[model samples]
Target: MRVAFVSLETVSHRDTETNQRFQTVLEILAARGHDVHCYCATFWDDERATLERDGITYHGIATGLEARRSFLIRLPFVLAASSPDIVHVHAQPPAAVLAASWGATLARAPLVTEWYGDGGIDDNRWTRLAANRGARILTPSELVATWIRERGADGDRVETIPNPVDLERVRDVPPGERVDVIYARRLDEGANLESLLLALAELRDRDWQTTIIGDGPERAMYERLASDLRIDDRISFAGDCSLEERIAAYRGAHVFAQTAEHCVFPTEMLWALASGCVGIVEYHVDSSAHELVEGWDRGFRTTSEAELADAILAAGDLEHRTFDDRFADYDRSAIAEAYLEQYRTLEEAYGLL
Candidate 1:
């Protein structure tokens, strides 16, 4: 089947975890003998167009038209060239969907969309119109699905499909000697990292060290908080380390913490679990942290700094060999296969030939 994946989100050549998820899916689909084409915003300067890297043909949509205007200018041309069996769009706020839905209509193909986060929905009329035109609206978690449904998408059209995580890259890392804790994700408004910093300060007094990975607008604030907390000496800001470095952090760290208020599918959490770290999840209404800790003995859900401090202290003492054994199934290959099953189901249901 020919699948055209239109993503308005940023795609870095740096190979961040977020980008890796989409890359992995593309590779998986290509390996399964499906024709996959990625129409994504080039968020980097790496030059190599229409090349085969991970078993898929990648076409970077060069655009200066700002995100809001991108759908209007590029969708028709992309649809004309790809002529896909299915039009798969990533993210929402119906502007892109509206454009893609129209292109799919023109090409006589089904439209499928993946809504990854809590982007506000203001155009109810347009969203409803688009939903009626779409074949399926895939979400990464039940929480996200609820939000999509509230925005006028039919309940029957929603499917929960998470971002794929490759566990092999994590499970095979050589054990490190340092007792490190990791926090890897975008440092944005939704991520309440102050609590983690305070907890780290408390743990610092107990001789614990933290390794912060990832770059974002909130990095400076977090740096300031670390300094004010007097734990700067014990914390290391790796600032958006490469994929190899991320795997190393997972292997080196004994505990992983996430303070995000609305996490959908945190790639770091999956790595921590696959690498056998004692996972510390702070509960928030919009987060899928609980789902990450579900059925795992090494994960703890907390609501306060005091509880987080306690969890950190306990986490520092967990046996790595045992914890790794507990989360062996959370590996990447298994997650990829699960995604394949979802795609296959969608293919059959939509009669993609």
Candidate 2:
């Protein structure tokens, strides 16, 4: 299939969960012999209009990410010239998606939008119009799907496709040193690590150790909070570790706690779960973290420090595991096929097949 993806800024321009998700998925599809092309503002060093990387081709619609108006103005004509079989566009900067719609129309292709709730569509004017022009919308979680629907997308036109992890990678890495608890994510304003710190403070009398993975500007603040709670001694802040290091930590840890203020998808939680850690998530009004743990025996959802602390203790009863095979359903290959399935469905429905 010839797939044309539209994004004003891709992972290269600004790394976000949504952009990285599409990059991984599209690269996977491209590796499988599909003709995948991403149309976005250029990030490559050269003046090349097109660049190839990770099995997919990239077409620069504008000079840089800052050229939003230029990207929108020139995107349709560029995509139309390419004439792909299906057009995939990002939900962010809804203007880009709307422009891609015109290009899709010119190429007689179906337009699909992916909205991860990371950004954009807050105003809703373009979101609604983007949906009006696109064939369908894909989201990482139902929380995001509901968000798009509330903004004026048809319920039937929006679908939930969870974020995926490279499960094979998880299975290959050996477990690291054993730890009692784990929390992973960029320590930003939404880190909410204090909640977990408070929970751990309450359990200070217990025998346990912790490893806080990832780093950000607020790392010092979280460390201070942990110190204020008198649990800093037990917490180790491993700054910005690699994927293997993270997977090892998750595999060795008995419990993984997620207390973020908000996230469209619990990506790290999924990795920890697949690595065999008991998943514990604290719910937030803007967060969809609870969705990942709703129905699983190894998962726990709590809303308070008291509950989170208690769940950590309760997880001790469960046997430790190095890995869980169930999450294979959310592996990269599964997600790649899901994307193709969505594309094929659109093709059949729109008579594009």
State which candidate has the highest TM-score.
Answer: 2
Candidate topping lDDT: 2
TM-score of each: 0.79, 0.97
Global fold similarity of model 2 (TM-score): 0.97
Poorest lDDT segment (10 consecutive residues) of candidate 2: 118-127
Q: In model 1, how large is the Cα lDDT of residue 33?
A: 77
Question: Over 4 Å off in model 1, which ranges?
Answer: 8-24, 39-55, 58-83, 102-108, 118-124, 131-133, 186-190, 202-205, 215-224, 322-332, 350-353
Candidate 1: what lDDT?
A: 0.71
Off by over 4 Å in 2: 119-121
**CA lDDT scores, all candidates in order:** 0.71, 0.88
Residue-wise C-alpha lDDT for candidate 1, range 12-130, written one tens digit per residue: 54444444555666776777777888776555456764545556666666542264575556776778667887787764446678788777777767778777664433446767665
Candidate 1: C-alpha RMSD to true structure equals 4.1
